[model samples]
Target chain A: MSSEDLETPKEKGSTGEKQASEAPKPVLSSGSFLLVDYTIRIKETGELVDTTSEKEAREAGIYDASKLYKPRLAIIGKGMLLKAIEDELVTMSVGESKTFEISPEKAFGQRDPTKVKVYPIRKFKDVEAPLVVGARVNINGKEGIIRSIGSGRVQVDFNPYLAGKTLVCNVTIKKIITDDKEKVQQILHNRLPDVDIQKFTIELAPPEVVITLPEEAYLLPNLQIAKRLIAKEIQENIQGIERVKVIELYTKQT
Target chain B: MSSEDLETPKEKGSTGEKQASEAPKPVLSSGSFLLVDYTIRIKETGELVDTTSEKEAREAGIYDASKLYKPRLAIIGKGMLLKAIEDELVTMSVGESKTFEISPEKAFGQRDPTKVKVYPIRKFKDVEAPLVVGARVNINGKEGIIRSIGSGRVQVDFNPYLAGKTLVCNVTIKKIITDDKEKVQQILHNRLPDVDIQKFTIELAPPEVVITLPEEAYLLPNLQIAKRLIAKEIQENIQGIERVKVIELYTKQT
Candidate 1:
């Protein structure tokens, strides 16, 4: 093959997709940072499990002002989103919306018989909660529900609430991020929930990005760990990125 | 003053008790680090609120296997212990034990009438807990208790449980810490719960202490914050300490 053919392949697949027809479809990979909106439900009972849309949550009688209702940016294969959904997105292109059904095994795993155990009713003495069936109870920090109660015995199923249920999810990939700065910011936002990501200044130095934290962020607890996680996120997700230098400036109080 | 008198002043009450009779009584200072075991009781009801002794906790019917029953190491001015008790400790010596009663103002504060609010019974629709009087309920992350129930209205008191109650605390200073290594370790234990403090090794180099973390501790979440807090604790409590270097060595798995 001529040099033109080799050059064409690089140019066509490269980030600057000048030739739209020749460019490959933007397929999601393991560490792809994606902005997505999704709604998850129990396939059998049509019960809503979770949703990113505020309108859907209000209609389903599960709206909470504390919860953020917006398109979530998540790294595909890091268990930020469900593994089954992540697997399905690997073959899909950007802006693709699909309704898919996930089996119990693929979703939360099948219910195990060993997880259901009967214990003396006195075990829940500290738990002032009612022992009614289907009511969730926290036993030794592990949350479960009282499945049955009789003869001073309470049957508690430690299995996850959705363990045996099939999940039906309607997921839309709003955008597949290619910009390194946005990816870093997304990762920073995910790690440091309280700090405003937009306030921090990021400067590109080719293989490294210097993140200068704002004055307000200097006194934040666990800031060093946040910086470390940000560095790790940049190293793993962004291509050709090697180093992340975080500068925290502390101005003396007057 | 002569050089001998100036030298004598430093040795008078600074870590040594040689001139105990000549000098003033050795009183606890604000920054003093002490190993203490304390028992707190409600003065009005004579009900035990807390204790460091396992026997005391068991007798009070409030013992938990999860709680660490030991003399806690605390800095006097930091409010690690009760502020009222801390004030009493300022007058105490190294090995002194004192039983004192603290007023409601000095203890958990007086009960405010404004904190008692009447809400509609429908406000408890989300709460699965029993609507009985004195039932603790968490509303918007602040824990409160139901006080009364009338026609369509339920009264909830958001005041702290100990509010309006005077506290009688029996406090004993077991030992005053002088060694910087033990001081650092004690601070580490206080900061990082569950992790074995013995695993961390501290090497003192005047104005700096290097803390070597074990292999298992390298992966512990938010270790940077723990290290930062350790440094701050050492600097504030221990004399001549400035810097704390935390080294995490990762060994190659063969």
Candidate 2:
């Protein structure tokens, strides 16, 4: 379905279609940015999963007023947005705000029953009370939260993302970020510090580009095989790169 | 922190120790059941994350009268419970309900920054307006629900399970199923039909029984992979099975 068709009951406007059509095609320049404030409600149940207030932003370390107040920015052609929502953003201009609904296919996928399982009651040594059904517990040594508790059986369901759930997220476009590969990389690296981008060196070999990484990265247990994996990722993600070479170098750091 | 010290402001009664000492431990046996209905809340924020409402239980396909009204159940050992909470359940008896506080370490554990990342705005095509700071957005196919948006930058942090926040869960001991392994598996599989118990064959290797799966199970795609993963999980979870043999049987059709 079209993006406009996904609006919630509260999102309807008299001239929404006209305004969207007449609105200037936002120019996503190199440094232009926008800031917006919005809340999220589940489309099916309208339950609020979460929302951010100005107070929360300040507490979260966002100090810059300009960036914090009107911080919605957009970048076109660059994958700087959610494909589902970005499709909507491209249809609006500055100062335009709209609430949209996304299906489970677009948001978080549907819940997977396979991801849920029953465990022996003994695993809950730390609990002092009796076990019951519908009790939510924490999975030991894993990034999972239990959804239910049963008889001599304890059911632990991994996050569908861990098990793969098609989620439907209703969101508002507050603003968009600009398109700056370096800035984006810095943001990504800053957010994911465990990922050693320094290990991978990128070089422009004209039409064909080559990337190299330290062999130690591969040897590191649980490391996400970056060089080859990233090479394939970059190729699939970016156009004009004819080929990518992943070279592994032996390092004596260990 | 001690359980008493961990009690947040919302805790209803005296600390867990005080309540445990006052209530007589109900004599629980096979068939002796308890019914409890409670809500799990975040102690610090007093936010309700999960609840065992009759409405929700009915919606989840649990139609038994006991499950609908007062589901009396027993608490077994570890695998059936969270180590921290299960440790607490052992001290309680039937018909008793308590609201206890669990530290983040015991609840959801510490938040890992490695899971956070900031992606380019271009990835969100349907989003028209700029991303606002603190607006929730989906990131890299994960529900980050946006934390912050900035120039050429969208700072999307993920920690849905609030890190370091104390959790308050109200538990009622309903009926505890028998501790028999086969019986437990039947209950779990019955509750969650997607879990394949047959795929996971139990091997009677004394003191260290093993559970094996057919080789074809692994070759199945994402959904099937998820199913097999759940099956293999049964082996690692069974209480008495110290050693598990995950054999890949080529003859079996998964």
Candidate 3:
């Protein structure tokens, strides 16, 4: 697709069209952090599968609940995870926690049957197994781990998870790192490159931090928050800066 | 909880404990933006309800195919949306797209009678008349927008979806933004705090970016990849910097 075709309308303020006066961006100077804790459950069964409560996780582990192996964590705006999660994380302040249920429509998604394929047992030449029904096996040449074993069909579903399971994740915003804007941007980009730092800005306010992007970078979808997250990190690490403001200077289109 | 009680064995690198030297830590830095064009047909009747084609959506819109309003967008790591979508998003990369079909069990999930509640029409005093059977109506305070209006009793089910329905979503990876270290920590804390920027280190290797945290921050889950993302982002914006590193000189007990 041509670059022009990819450009969508910029996200306007919630009221639409009316530009909200830019408020004084709170600088998250050094020593600002967000602490968050959460639990994840199956939306259908309401069964707890994951949690940030290490103590509860340990307790569940004692009961042999392998679900407690890890708890979900993320830094707001860093793009280390999902935009929705980061959006929620950035909205929270210290010591504040909330639980929201995500639908299968919104959470993971409806399971796809095409993802479930029946492979022959010979595919597992190296894999040793009792190979009984309901047994889990590994696919030697596939992206997913085996979920179930069936009749001679050897149903080796490629999806990492059983289709149609709704997942609930409880997240706690533990701390927000506001310093090192440039570094935070590097983290989000996954590589250090030659770009103008002046092109970025971070504004920390309630609910989320706003990162303005240069016209050249605007085509990157969901990148607005990614920039804001980096700025938030710098504001958090630097002293006296309540928030990081990334101002993307207009650059000639490449 | 006592400080000692809070101290727990770090699960980092546990997945490959046997191959420690070559084993990359499970940084969990998976994130992707996907745009999928797909169609959903009932498993039993083969009736198409949802599709990526706008023409199809408009046609299906005429029916009670509430399933096709929004295209599925899954953000993996953060778990902000649905678990199934998140799982799929995590494993994908940018510029990649796929179409798949999900079973009812893996999509909306099996219908639960317990979730379906019957209420009285008096409860909906504000509702307009002509509440015929099969007509949708709102229920007491929940604002379901109505599923079906029944005799004497209103079968105002709370589920916003038609249970046991199969859905298809065509997903495209728009972009993948990895969380930076400082931001990841802030997300954990829920607020941004000013801190010594030198404390955290960022590494950009395969699987994800790694953030080496001080002992005080060691207990922070998913710290490694968060740092890597930050480092990668820094590398992108700064000149002559291939990678960003975080080093801690002192430690404090939280």
Candidate 4:
């Protein structure tokens, strides 16, 4: 600021215009790995379905301390988000916030009548527990809920809970992650949300990332599944991250 | 009384020879899925290493009646067996038995000295139980055993227990499974050894095989993993069976 002010000597014709034209800002594109915070709701009722922002969560009376509220990693054109949201992200720049309305068709598909069926009351007798009218039941490997039961017959609906609902989404692109280490950490956090993300430390050498897991994450059930899913996400999202080594160090107690 | 005894006298000269040449016998190939019973030992010490035959197991004082003693499915060239054994099986036929020697290099590779390391004794003090000389310990995600403890230093050897040992294997190909139904049942039996194989009823309509799981196998731990492994084995072994449906039926108790 001082250099420009001293050179102009209080009389600048087009100095501000020239500086703006010298550098261009970055824009998000397809295949870009992004960190964003979003809040999704039902368009008709304005009911909050999901959100990544803690402030919005508290305002809606759905705040949970156990759930981490942080910027999420999203890969464009990966179908991770709705197709409408992915299509809109291409024209977005960093730090921009937008609200978009998604129709029912673009959101969950329309509910079908065939998804609702009737079953015999005897089917629930084998279950060890009593069946309620609205409780979900798995029959013959298919999941459905009991809608009504009368006269030795039961009615069940197999449609998705959110089918035939329009969505309203408010999103903000926080930052774009160009570093491989951060990308790998974000993907690992996505898979293991219960673990504190700050405890992880990542070392990056091209084509190899070594992640040091915390002591709390050692005894997690299905640890191999988590490792496999994290590896898949890292390989799919981050370039040059072909090999992953998860290290767990045990130290002597003092 | 017999067909050969009742044949006409005019065709007696070449009838027996002609019948033998009309049918061809089956031989195992690289991709053939076989059910075999084998016993493996260390050639130098005559120590029993492994066996799949009940008689051999009983003779070696390792028989467990709870363990299933049926033939095991081994896919040739799939690294299910040692490379030496796999190479030798291509020339084998059904009902044939062979004893072959496998050198240490061809089996588990020779032991390396660099894999053995000496750590301070205090490193093991935090372990909940007392440390023994030969107890296996997991150190930083790598499994190793305590080889020796002397002068406040503990020596841990990371080599496999069977490393640097030559193996002598006696194998007999009981049957080569060519039927899709039998192949599916064998794979299921391999996954769920406690359940009776006869309880599994398989219906094979090309590209789809339906297996009905018995009541005993319904509550098994990790049922999804068993199903996935069975599906993978069927797909990898049987060419035409693509879909696998495992049905578990539950009925009301009297």
Candidate 5:
């Protein structure tokens, strides 16, 4: 029985309310780093929005070779794994899996009809004639799908493709990350998804971190920017670090 | 003035040869870093080739704002600062200047008649019709100046423009960089000419040189490649350096 139910029983409280007051619920700690494998689908069209499983992605014909398919690390209160879903996970434990529905109100929000508009065909300078009706376009940095092109007028729908959709999320809580070093490595992996973070040697001296990058990381595209970003994320998230030294030692090639 | 004349003169030696061997000719030390201002002209046509002075470049109508025009650093033995010029500089001391002639053999090699070739106009995929003769063209990684274009044929001269001509060189020795730290910074300035090298901070511990890059260097074009190149240059040339740490520290802006 709940402490509030037992201690402060209202004189006019219904018997049904008193009967359902069983036990205090278990809640997962906020900011707990969780490793989760998840798949999100739009409830109405059954369209696959995202999946961490390579097999699932391939089956749905949504696989991208450039993307790394792996379990995502979601901090409990960070809201990266859908806020409503994270709220649901707060009451669940590791080793448990759940499938739940999120309404449009909590998901991408209802589609606004005003976002659909018409423009002159000349406005799309890059689009060729005999245009595909469903082709996607970027008009002034806003992504939209073409609805129709008739008589020199082109109709465009600028609402987010996922708007107004109810999401069916299937998620499994694999484990909670507790080690500080592993957390930093996971952060690095998130930034440099292509490179193997395990090869990098990270020495954490309190108030300083020395990250020795692997040889493969030397000429990777945007590697310098990524290194700076990795350092920034590590310093901001991982406490007690005043400096991050990302060192890349170039050995003589024979 | 000949030391050899006063000391040991062979009985068979010519008087002219003995008179020229005056006072054991003083030579500049090899590998000495020197700042030299020079102007080069083709002796035949008197066409200006190169000059270190900005005013001279402007007067010649070939001034490019992209280039940094100042006294150039010439390491005595390094082939970069013209071998013939270095040989001449060795005979002349500081506070002295000399005007000398370099033949085609010692300067750019004599222009070969076989190097000039006629090609079909179609070979130049990027050239437009009614092309400007004497315009520079790069064909198959080799640079050439166009001589004529007509009847589906274009005549290209691939010889170095300065080839086959004797060069009249007017030069002055400005200063020799002596400080070891300034030498490193000067090397850096040679690599990154647009940014001021004085703003960068360098900490030298034997076998390890730490270079703190300025904020202006953070987003330069090919900055990552440039940083790696800088580290490689410092390690290769600088003495007692086993490691080069080019550190760029980013601070949060308020």
Candidate 6:
């Protein structure tokens, strides 16, 4: 394989035709960092479940300003994605596209009749959301959907929101991260999913991986545990990294 | 002046006689980190109020296991020491001991009879401590001392505890830290009073002072603000500290 074939997807423009006809796909494996674009939908009602494509998300009325719109990072066999998608990813290659259907059993699980329960309206006094049908609520730690609210009573379904429904998922692998440092950072970023990975400035120096965390993450719950876990994971997954030095800079503005 | 005079209090064994008779005490000034031993008592009753010495605390039946029985840190002109004591510290030299009395007006302020109020015993149900006389309680954010509890009524005195009494304060300056980095650290330590400053591993590197925080401090409230303040204080107080880098390590046990 030529080095040109190994170039990042952005730089290797219009390689699609050559990739489809001439080039052989690389055998992707566990811990591989794949930048993938995916669009999920409910096959029965053709409703958009989720999408990495900004256009599709905007069209489906699920566009969020806070969300990253580019190709999503999916680490193979690391559970950065659904088990079903990860399983398919291990068999596929870079630049490959696949469409699959996940049954209810493999998704959020089939809905159970026993999961539904009814409680008096007074029981929801502490709930901040209005007592209306279809509003989600958590009563005594059990997450439920308010199925009906009438006769001074509320019926809640404890089943997961997507239970009993099959989902159609279309995915395209855009690029595979090859650099060792970038790969390690993506894993740490996955652990701190809320913060952008780019903000976690990481530098590799043979035995030490020095990472300076963003100031905002200084107060994150279990941040210490997360840092240790990030270090441990990097040492275990990436070769030659004996130490992971995590620096938290408290700027003037905090 | 002997170099031995600059040694830590732990190493200055039996220098009391020599210090008293021979050595002209070095002048002290503001922002000096002094390790001071102190004992406070109610002048009228001779009741032990507080003491730094373990022997005195044990004798007074106020020994606490969680407390570090050592000379307390008193940063001159800093609020870490009481304003009255700080006012005295600037004039007092090292290795000197003094006993002084502060009146109610200079202490917690004179007792106000109007500050006392009578309330029904039911008002104290939410108070965890028993509503006994002399018990301290805080209601609706206002701290008050329970003066009497009888006949279905409770008399609460909202005046300061030390009000209407004079306190006898005895203090001895044990040692004064003179190292620039140590001085900055003591200042930071004063801000984070709950945790020992020793755990905050600090290394001075010319323009940069790198501090490694203990993992336990990761989840502290307003930790980000605290860190920023620490860095800002160090830079502003210590010369040549152009940068302050803080590191937090999370171990396997988290």
User: For this target, which candidate reaches the highest lDDT against the unseen true structure?
Assistant: 6
Candidate 4 lDDT tens digits, A1-254 = 12232211111254666657854323456667777779999877788888998888999999999888887878888777888887777667666779998887888888887999987888787764357787878877877778888998989888876678888898877776666677777787888988888888888875767777776876566755776677667766677667666655333222
DockQ of the candidate models in sequence: 0.04, 0.01, 0.01, 0.01, 0.17, 0.40
lDDT of 1 at A36: 79
Please give, for residues A134-222, the per-residue lDDT of candidate 1 as tens digits. Answer: 88999888888889999999999999999999999999777667777888887777777667768878877757777766657655767
CAPRI level of candidate 3: incorrect
Docking class of 6: acceptable
Model 1: colliding residue pairs? none
Query: Which stretch of 10 consecutive residues in model 5 chain B shows the poorest summed lDDT?
Result: B1-10
- For all predicted structures, in order, the TM-scores are 0.49, 0.29, 0.29, 0.46, 0.77, 0.76
Q: All predictions: root-mean-square deviation over Cα?
A: 13.5, 30.9, 32.1, 22.4, 9.9, 6.4
Candidate 5 per-residue C-alpha lDDT over B130-249 given as tens digits, one digit per residue, 9 for 90 to 100: 456988888888888898888999899999988888999988777656556776787778778888868878888867777777778766778768767777766666667777776665
Off by over 4 Å in 3: A1-33, A46-49, A62-73, A129-136, A143-151, A176-254, B1-254
Q: Give lDDT tens digits, candidate 2, residues B83-102.
A: 55555555565445677888
Q: Could you give candidate 4's per-residue lDDT for residues B110-169 as a string of tens digits? A: 988899999998988766535889889888778888999899998999998778888999
- Candidate 1: C-alpha lDDT: 0.77
Q: After TM-score superposition, what is the CA distance of residue A146 in candidate 2 from its true location, in Å?
A: 57
Stretches of candidate 2 exceeding 4 Å from the true structure: A1-254, B1-38, B56-81, B111-136, B141-143, B150-152, B179-182, B185-254
- Give per-residue CA lDDT, model 3, range A35-55, as digits (tens): 345777777776667565767
| Candidate 5 positional error at B206, Å | 3.6
> Where does candidate 6 clash, by residue pair?
none
Error of 2 at A88 (Å): 64
Scored by Cα lDDT, where does model 4 land?
Answer: 0.74
Where model 1 places Cα greater than 4 Å from the true spot, the runs are A1-254, B1-24
Better of 1 and 6 by DockQ: 6
